[model samples]
Target: MPDAAPVLIAGCGDVGMRLAALLQVHGQRVLCLRRNVAALAPGLPGFAADLADAASLRALPRGIRRVVFLPAPLAREAVAYRTVYLAGLANLLDALDEPALQRCVLVTSSAVYGEHAGAWVDEDTPPAPLGFNGAILLAAEALLLARLGESRGVVLRLAGLYGPGRTQLLDDLRNGTARVPRDPPFYANRIQVDDAAAALAHLLALPDAASVYLGVDDTPLPLHELYAALAQQLRAPAPGIGPPPPGIGNKRLRNARLRASGWAPRWPDTRAGYAALRVDPA
Candidate 1:
């Protein structure tokens, strides 16, 4: 493989770390920017910068050819979601012009297609966000798309991500707080962290300009099944089955667009993904 361009990962969280590792393995100079630089790999170059402060963003090293923008934890809260989303993105964009940056990949979520009750959501699916989080994500998508026309950029709408240090269900199970709603037929999509990282690497290597892709596995497992698998894996007592609360049922997402892009997932289903996590929890 040819040497990759200098890449900057804005958020060195679980996904960010995986991306950074892969970029480094591919022979790219990676610079990670995050509030907690200690969380990143010790050998990787990282910059401590507050996502909310535009001035701090200016400190990002210039001559960055590629960038992966991962939303900070601040985007999770309902109230502060939009402010941080818009402000953080705008601040980053203001820090550098497109001519100086070769390409950018914005990591977004499937929440933009909020509450997909039995409906299959894909890249072309119109966003119908329900709650504040989804609304903010949708707004962020719009802003990113608007800027995409001006630069070589793409948006990756990822499914529920799981892998090393990010076992969402496993974490709940270990804490003895795994909640399994009684509602049957309620399923959700997921993708392993390694798969997500590979998808990003594939996009970065492609010669294409701008595109929107859904990063998800082939199977969308039922919520109860997911919890039960975790319980079994951990040898812990399974949560009592109960009816799923209103508006919190199965949501399936389609990744036909991404699959069509010549990138195949190593973990095509959640069962395989979860099975791989059966070893040490750490």
Candidate 2:
């Protein structure tokens, strides 16, 4: 035995479970922690702990070497973002300060870029969050960088996640609720859920992970294009064009930095990724 604690996945949800599966295939045991232990995968030991509660974090195992912190806010509001991304992350960091810790990889949002004019962004682009959602995530990243530096921790800003069982786009198009930006053809990035999880695991083993990397697919497409594809698949009416929605990010996310790190998404584009996904009407 390595005489070390299992890898800790704080907030082990669907993506976390995916990461855990990948790691376990390589003979690694992962400690799964979340507010709802029942949600964890079978055959894995899980702890019910809320990152927002400092005391609950005390239940974290000793001798943890690596941590993947990925807690999603229960809501999209600012206060909810602050409580989960900021306070919850702070509590976890406070609880795990052991010398045995090797790295802490954080999953964040691409909203931190704040580019609403179809600009291309990457790790080097200075984060200028325009909304509270981006602001909260940026604040968390700042805190993480200040607290752990590049050697001990890194951040992964992921694009929109879509994959099996996650078909909001399909649902919207099928229900005649999908809207596309008419003028600028609102553009954004996306990554399949499996790719997001794989990116985290890739960061886990990289010898020199950068301070930050954008987790997105190679293709950045207009909202209408994505919607149209789903419409065709669902045999529904094409999505109508309208003014851009409030949070429909108008920027292109670049994944070269992550790709340069030798990680490429299996589903490199929305067309290929969404091919096998179907929205369940039940």
Candidate 3:
């Protein structure tokens, strides 16, 4: 493939836009694909095509060298996930000329680990996904590798993402609506949105990127402790004890492999990250 070939970002959204900005700073040619071209920023080169509709993808730009697939489903249902992650990914790969493509990175979630109960998980951990989302994503990961070869496929299993406009946790804490499980100490892991975008860009430039990497920050605090700290930061009343959040497996994600690959998070700890948000809204 020629070096001039554009890097295609499938399912372009918040993280995709951030990654595109990073790549554009370095003068890399970026092409974005999404359902709505109008939603894209002012001058970004993009195409409007729904991944669920195979025929719509036929008109995509040709000879794309690399891809970043980080699509979000229309809803939180099983059918939505299957359509977007599994069938949508399949349609994209099939539509493209696979021979000329160098890499296709998929942004999946850590839910694949499924209820670790405060245990630690790494990329090497065998996936035991419990919910439909995780199971379908695991299947999508397999499909990517099977179609594009393992060496050319990359999977980023990201922890909870929070930053910028994604401040629901902070809002909940401020209004005393936040509730967390405290008896068993449910763990929470996350990466700031900027850091998550940086990680995606890092993998794109990595020459010897691994097949799978965990996208999480350094600290994985217990849910109650994290909520308490946020409450303290906001000077609000602490959240009441309640049940753990559904479907999110309780495990501390280890990003050792990704860190070892020469990538580090700007926000290693959520406390400091959240503190920055307090000082400056965005």
* Candidate number achieving the greatest TM-score relative to the actual structure: 3
TM-scores vs. true structure, each candidate: 0.88, 0.94, 0.96
Candidate 2 lDDT tens digits, 1-282? 331468899889999999988888878888888889887788777878988899988867777889998987888898888998899988988898656768889999898877558888888988887788888888888888888888578899998999987867777888898878757777858999999999998898787778999999999988888778767767889988787767535889999999999999999988878876644233
Q: By TM-score, how accurate is candidate 1?
A: 0.88
In model 1, which residue pairs have backbone atoms overlapping below 3 Å? Answer: 182-242, 182-243, 183-244, 187-250
Give a tens-digit lDDT track for model 3, residues 174-258.
7889999998999999999989989988887788688999999999999999888888888889999999998777889999999
Instruction: Write candidate 1's Cα lDDT for 107-190 as tens digits.
Output: 878777756666777877777766666677777767876775533678888888888777566766778876766554577688
- In the predicted model 2, the residue pairs found to clash are none
Model 2 ranges with Cα > 4 A deviation: 1-4, 278-282
In order of lDDT, best first, we have 3, 2, 1
Candidates 2 and 3 compared: the better one by lDDT is: 3
Root-mean-square deviation per candidate? 2.8, 2.2, 1.8
Better of 1 and 2 by lDDT: 2
For candidate 3, the 10 contiguous residues with the lowest summed lDDT are 273-282
Clash count of each predicted structure:
4, 0, 0
